[model samples]
Target: MPEYTTGKPWRLSAFPPLLWAVALLLTLSLAYAAQSGATYILIDDNLDTELAPPYALLQEGKALDYRSTTRVDRLMNGLPRNALRPGLQPLVGLMALFPPLEAYLLHELLVRLAGLLGMYLLLRRYGLPGPRLAALCAGLALAWAVLPAYTAYGVSVLGQPWVALALLNLRRGPGRWSDWLVLVVFAFWSSLVLAGMFVLAAAGLLLLRDTWRHRRIAWRPVLGLLVLGISYGVVEYPLVYSLLVKRQFVPHRLEFDYARLAPGGVGVGLASAGRYLLLGQYHAGLFLRAAPLLAAGLALAYAPAGAARRRLLRKLLAGVGVLVGVALFCGFYPQLIGVVQQTVPPLRAFNLSRFHFLTPLLWFGVLAFSLRHLPGPGLRAALVGLQLLLGLGMNTEWTLNVRRLLGRLPATEPTYAAYVAPELFRRIRQDVEARTGQQPARYRVACLGFAPAVASLNGFYTLDAYQNNYPLAYKHQFRELIAGELARSPELRTYFDAWGNRCYLFSAELGKNFRVAALPERAVAHWAFDARSFRRLGGRYVLSAARLLHPEASNLRLLGEYAAPGAYWHIWLYEVR
Candidate 1:
């Protein structure tokens, strides 16, 4: 044996068989419990477009707006919208482009298996005692449940942890070409943009390196440095290519709105909003609260001196560099900030603060690594316990004050809430099928809350809801309906007419609430018929095309109500012939 200088002969090697057995038992138990919770969520919430990019990609393929490159169509076109722009980034979409069955298997592998493997690699790289590493990782997964985004999506989304661990390894390496290759792949795979910023910082620091003395410089870190060049290349090359060569998608609309730099404005350029996502609040706030400890860690790692100091210091520097880089880029990058402000909500609709997701992880990781090399177990434990207590206490006080001021809800209930109306949709689909002898399978519907849900599960298109294609919808390309410019275009009017003619019509008041002012008043009135002509179907209500004299529907009928008792509101269905 090399030495038993460490504790308990590295528990993993000591009791491999026993450890595997225990792991199996715990995993099975956890899987069973998760399956139970999985029952309450809808198909969209299950493994679909609201999250997992792979599923989103698959949905994009099913929709076939493949050539529709603009942002509006990108969300609305739905298939793996990211698949439309094939390459290394949007790695989730790239994975999705594989054969469906294989894509699913690979996606499962990446999101779930890779995450576990990533954690294992991290522990191994850090030279943690196997048992201690296992304990730490298990505690993290269970208590903190660090993979909340993955859990929410019902997909692993392992890219974040995978990148974190890989970058951590790259920090202390002059390894084989394969190591560098893996780092490159990891860099390309970060869709969260946090990873991209980290890769950039890592590369930048490498550029500033003059020499690696006691330890010879390796090619892996150098290879990994390529990621920084790649990022600049990605943005600059496209614009240059458009301008010089083909002029593909240009006027080169590189927007620069510095007002976003103002405290509250949502403009894109040089704004706090973008930076806030990566840097998060702590760093973004006055004094760069995390900076000193970050500086201390860097000082220990880089300040010339002792060999013992250097080894540990190097690791700290590399890790801290990655953390700081991620923070700075996320704080600085305007487009990314705007993206979060646009796509995710409560973050968007309410606070317009998109950075909260990555912020917690950044601080937590920094805190963990900063304390990693404390002298002894007892001392380390005390130091960690103190930090945790202090940090948690501070956060609690901050949260309480913020809650008192802003009246925020506790984490359990989502703020800016939308209802779960799965039963309502199922009823609509069923009744439409029964009355018209045609299922709602072939055509799309236009209800607010249930359109994406319907399109995802029922495999139909929805006019009112856009998937990942926010550019078109948000930019108002579908302006004819939203701005009451319905009279302006024959094509837009035709689309409205066809939508109205569908056998399925979800109720209007419900439609109005869901649309959030996108739908033209005329579109709702023309398609939904009138409040006066429809009859109530007991718990459900419907309007018939027969009641309203229109060129489209002359003979329509009321459908039986499809709603959970006590949950009835606006989402009723009507069958028009």
Candidate 2:
């Protein structure tokens, strides 16, 4: 057994298991309440396109045809076959067992519970003891449960707890061969982009610190970790290369506006950091309110003399160092951003604000560690109680805010709900089936002005898609097709952003010639409603909200119109002859 150095064993009695149970129950209750009377499948942002097809396939017990039906396939012309992380496939498979909504809820609940458990284990590994440890665990579990950062529709939330678990194990060092194996597996299974980056950052920092302290680099463990990371990469090389190299999907980029960078960018970044660290979101007043208490705690904790003060300062600095480093990269250095982008394209998506997620964990860890060193037991207990109160308050606020937002969601029939009305999709499918007398795979649907993602939800083989990982060849082909007189030198029509991301604009002449208006955002060379192009792409139906000049084109027949309450525009369905 490890020797207890900080306190008497009596004071460090085993924390009651009931405390953990209560914390978990509270967290689950909050999570369930937040989603009450609402669909578990969140349809925000890219989630509409990303998960809908997978969910549909899972329901049908059909293998994921990543190349044929998904948005990636639609946009990229089936190149790079699979774009999703392999880690997420297992969860999707598991969720397929139950009804879609129930499956989603169950998955979400399990992930949240796992996160709480991981955090509890992490705190225990940090040598925290007794009621204080129990309180901290409960508080953190509750806080994390309600935190907005974890509620997003991406894999980041799923990856977070695993990342924490990996960090905990990494900090303790591998005890055996089995431990090493688990670490490697967990690291790889965590979200490739978010958790992978966290592991790299944390491991690098810890290594640097250890080397600096010992005055020599530890080669064996480092090499072992490197081997594990490399092995994981080797296994996932296809997916990695597809996204990083072929797709050039730059999710995050440095906000290097000269006006924003100079004079006030640092201050703004700092303020943003503080907001994220405290409230996990942007609210000027919340930061202002919490700043004094945080400042007082740090000042009081570090005021004492001796080695303890130095240690506390070092812990505080470690957390601050990460935040500061990210801020510098994000706002202070444009040239450095360019260099990093060129060398490490995968890390381009490492935005400064994301470090906010890590900051609270570090700060809480430091605060928990420093509590034992306070002047007296009473003061220590008081500080811990205060932290628990603060955590509860923050969690309550977050829960209420989320509930309020969720309450605003349109209360429609279960089938025709969320981002795209299911009723509309069903009608479209029926129409197509009636027209063809069978649901054929070759028949493609195209959405011109409406979001293309709706096609995926309805199980339509679509000709339009909105995705970051668009195929280079397809993009070039589409650009050339739309180039008209500039077909020989299409670069003249293409525009590249500051980051060299290419986007093609349609000239007024092309719009006049094609008779297309109100093109969807991020359209292929701003192409919309070209009957010839649609026919060539095997498109049988076109859905649009825009006004087309020749609505009664000889080859096109208007099928129906649809409009749902709270929807922005009327949907017009046309069958191409």
Q: Where is model 1 more than 4 Å wrong at Cα? A: 1-13, 16-113, 123-181, 184-194, 197-201, 204-219, 224-369, 382-423, 437-442, 466-475, 484-561, 565-570, 574-577
Cα lDDT tens digits for candidate 1, 392-414: 24432233323533545243221
Clashing residue pairs for model 2: none
Could you tell me the lDDT of residue 277 within candidate 1?
A: 32
N/CA/C clash count, model 1: 17
Error of 1 at 241 (Å): 10
lDDT per model vs. reference: 0.38, 0.48
What are the root-mean-square deviations of the candidates from the true structure over C-alphas?
A: 11.5, 8.4
- Model 2, global lDDT: 0.48
Tell me the lDDT of model 2 at 71.
Answer: 35
lDDT of 1 at 380: 40
Tens-digit per-residue lDDT, 1-577, candidate 2: 2346677564323545435544555554564443423433333333445554455455344434433234334332332334443424444655566644455555556555555565566556553556545665555444444333332233344335444455445545644564456446554444445445555666677778888999987665576557557755754565565555764332312222222222354576566545444454321111212432453365555567887677767766765565556544444443444456566654444443344435445555555555544454555555555654555455433344345456643232121133455665677678767877868355766665445555566566665554434444455544432344244233333221122122222333232122122223122332233566656656677776553455554256677876555343456777775
TM value for model 2: 0.68
